[model samples]
Target chain A: MSNARRIIVINPNSTPEVTSAMRDALDDRFLCLDIPEGPATIVTDRDVAEAGPRVAALAAAQEAPLAVIVACFSDPGVAETRAAVPCPVIGIQEAGVAAALALAPRFGIIALSELPIARHRVRLERMGMLERLADEVGLSGVSAYAAGHDPAVYDELLAAGRRLIASGAGAIVLGCGGFGPRRAVLQAALGVPIVDPVLAAAGVALSVTGGQR
Target chain B: MSNARRIIVINPNSTPEVTSAMRDALDDRFLCLDIPEGPATIVTDRDVAEAGPRVAALAAAQEAPLAVIVACFSDPGVAETRAAVPCPVIGIQEAGVAAALALAPRFGIIALSELPIARHRVRLERMGMLERLADEVGLSGVSAYAAGHDPAVYDELLAAGRRLIASGAGAIVLGCGGFGPRRAVLQAALGVPIVDPVLAAAGVALSVTGGQR
Candidate 1:
């Protein structure tokens, strides 16, 4: 209840289910917004690039947001949104990566699918955190489109998690925002830290939520 | 309450007030331990190195700890404690740094004293996080010995916070666990994200706690 400041988590995909999942994971302070004009889901660099301005537009329209969390793993419009808004605009991938760093020396990320792997690499490079990354593995069949509603996705996540650990990852970061609630499950199964980006953003949100403007 | 796993926050310092401050900032899941054999305050690299094995010994003696948080800002014994403990051993400096990364591209640290600057640089280099730090400034006179008991320390912290911001820090990390309770005040005064090192470790604690061994 103390996380009672106004923070908007904009899911720049047309999936209401993803929005619902985010709402379930976050508290009342976080208003999860689903863009009707967005792509089915963001996966490839193309999807991420296309989703950028649409997300930025929606983010620009929000009234007095203390902070905005770009909830997509590909982080569409995160840079543009920050310029558009008066407050901080955080990306889930960056938040999850930071959470991973907090836990271990070498961390791995499990993405929804292999398509966004390139995008993540670029973001990691920009953040200067690429050196600490052990590796990033993607689920073979779990697309970002179905990630929100699929309980079956957990199996794929667990399998990828095993490979990440075997690859020398000390902690695992769930790169997709759709993997929000399954963080504990992965942590228990993998016996290492599992970072849920949405949840990770909450700590940053709590720190700066009143208003930086 | 979901951070229900047993996590021990070990303050490798002789000051009980610092331990008490940690307990207040954290929840019941975090059992704060004040080491009687440690230095009254850890500032210099000598203080950090000396406290290492002593904190490691205390950590080794604890039974069934899900994770151990080396709650000192200097993070004494963190490496040694990790080797001695079966579960995760997180240091507040690393956690605070990661929390800073979550909020912004570049961050700053406000330490208890200038003596720990060299030690922090060594640790930051080891973690591969030195580049992300905008700056690390220490309060002129505050010691870990009196940090826990001084409500008056807020003024000193605010002054340092301004300097860090001016030096291009996007967020301010309370480098000392002794600065845990004053996070909100600093955040408000500085108009930037304020990280409480003790609290930052909790999110990492939650992800990996309840037995990573």
Candidate 2:
């Protein structure tokens, strides 16, 4: 069973609390990997630069992967890692957006902070899906490190979810891997689908890996 | 049980055989309703225009619905229906594309003929996702009415699937409702995830409507 082909979801940030929260958030069906080399925290574009090569290198070194997920919403090294691996390399943001699109015509994003909001925009634009983003809000001062563990992040996310729905987002995406645990409770409050990016990527991975072929 | 909230998957075209096949292709969880007023078959842009308002009116009149699906590959009237409906209104083309994005970076679409191929391009262009399309191929002479019952349509689809894989499609989408039943079989032969547009839309509906909100 240990040798069974697995989907590896790499949490690129090196902060232990962040990694631990992400590991707990992900389903047991996937292998949650925390790299020893990326930036200790991804608070800015500079941190994303520091994390990309480490993620690419880490993913390239994996064995028997059915798929790999770049768990950061910024998707720092997903493109590079895709070419380096034989299996599908899914980015959390893209997977989440895809799922959100299925749930509703337009979607909103809940980013841990401003940097990832910009990152999400860039990636969506590149994928030609920026138009589908109804709106995006960032938790003020809540870094990815804090988002991973602090329950205090709840109220801010809920308030933002209301505003996003008011802005015409039929569904919302938890844009940080750290926000994965908050999806269900938030969706219940928001009364719309709340997509957890890591879980969304895992679902996509499972669809591809569920069968032997 | 009879009055349970349902997802309405409207086949949009009025041809009886087409409706029958789509009913067979859809999982029982959804209610597949073929319109009495759209074009007899959707082959050209004129048919799309004729089908659009009929789809909108039919969708608006539905009762106790969790979601509505515009099941035609051309997605006639999806935008109009979305505006008319209180719940999620899913179009098969957009849903299929979203599922394909989850499976891989680029996807190929299999259309029934030259006309639906054109409609697919226009819609993808409107969505700003035209760039992500690897390629699209159509069965040379098959019409939607014939496609629904004819098993002989298999070989052309298989040949097209091979070329699409060669053209760099990591996944292939069955772009018409009639193509839905062939999905699992063709996917086995092609070695990639084959997206059935109706089923893809259904998955999204379930995500949004699965729980009573």
Candidate 3:
């Protein structure tokens, strides 16, 4: 059997919705691990990256196999976390990308702001997936919950999607956490695949970890 | 700004190559979290989906915040994990689909085997992303490494990809860990966006959890 003794989930953002959404996404998938008594935890501090080392140090004291997930879109302490922990560490973005590649040949990214394109590019390169990226389209200075505030964001999303599809992208990844609820509307309009990182990461984690407890 | 203290990464399979690839994918670009110190760990072994909850229970003991990632494709312990931990947990497949939706409009999942199609579909449903799916094409009964073991398998992959694309798939995902090294080659032939789950998951993880640790 797999020996993942413990897991820690860190939400870098202060927003409870994102954290809760992430939590809800993984609810009830690993029933077997519970019967055997496994462990999992969630951290809600926006400052996890800098403090990550201290956390890892504490987790190491448990003397069991552990896995850590940087739960924010920014993945602050991923490297430091890796260096601090002897076991493997993963970020949801990394896990999401890996899982996406497993299912799709090409994919696109939807961002909340236009400026993050550079950041997204850098991320793809770091992950060695630049070549596979068809495009990175921004939602044009909107918050994750922009759709709720402005119904027009949906139209903007659709228009942006057309541009990405024209650019030869086959799949779309919703960059903002707020877009999760809009997936159905967008997917129907785009008539293509749309990926929400939260959901994608949750699924891949389950598969790779195989419902560890 | 975030206060997550720990994170866990669980790998469902025993293969070291997969683990190494996962590690390499997140080697750099962890600074998204905006924190300097982060902690992480990787778990290997354990099969079937039952092992996740046991692992998560162990993480709940820490006083700090935590994030958990299931590194396998099946998303083994997500359900139990959520119940076990007070923090958020993510899976690679879940993260992957989210990222893919951001980039592509329609994506096809070219998986390693047919047996997992139903499971993959179920995962898609859980994420509320079933509509984004164009197709779930299996690679004609092949293991991830089978392509490398024999050239014929590579040809089969190519053939499967072509069929998927023709069937209205705009992008592809490399569904297995064995396909890690072949992403570039597949992209070259497909001329469309492809989602590498590992890469996507890592990137999204970094973005969500805060980058550059």
Docking quality tier of candidate 3?
A: incorrect
Deviating ranges (above 4 Å) for candidate 3: A1-213, B1-7, B28-47, B54-66, B144-152
lDDT of 2 by residue, A102-129 (tens): 6676889988776667777887888778
Question: DockQ of every model listed?
Answer: 0.36, 0.25, 0.03
Q: Compare candidates 1 and 3 on TM-score and give the better one.
A: 1
Cα lDDT of model 1 by residue, B74-152, tens digit:
7788878877877878888888888788777789988887878888898889888899889988787687745645767
lDDT of each: 0.78, 0.77, 0.54
Summing lDDT over every window of 10 consecutive residues in candidate 1 chain B, give the lowest-scoring window.
B204-213
Q: Estimate each model's TM-score.
A: 0.89, 0.78, 0.45
lDDT string, candidate 3, B1-213, tens digits: 244454455555555555555554444322112001111211222333344554455445444434455555666666676567654455667665655554344567777667777888986775556676778877666643353344777787788788878877756766664455565577667765555665555544333333212
The per-prediction tally of clashing pairs is 0, 0, 211
**Candidate 2 on B1-213: residue-level lDDT in tens?**
468888898888877677776666555567888987666668888988888898989999999577898988888888898779877788888877887887777899888887678778888887666888999998876766765456788888899999999999988888787775577688778877787777666655654554211
For model 3 chain A, give the 10-residue run with minimal summed lDDT.
Answer: A30-39
Off by over 4 Å in 2: A1-8, A13-41, A46-65, A101-106, A143-151, A165-170, A191-193, A206-213, B1-8, B13-41, B46-63, B103-105, B143-152, B165-170, B184-193, B206-213
What are the clashing pairs of model 2? none
Best candidate, DockQ: 1
Poorest 10 consecutive residues by lDDT, candidate 2 chain B: B204-213
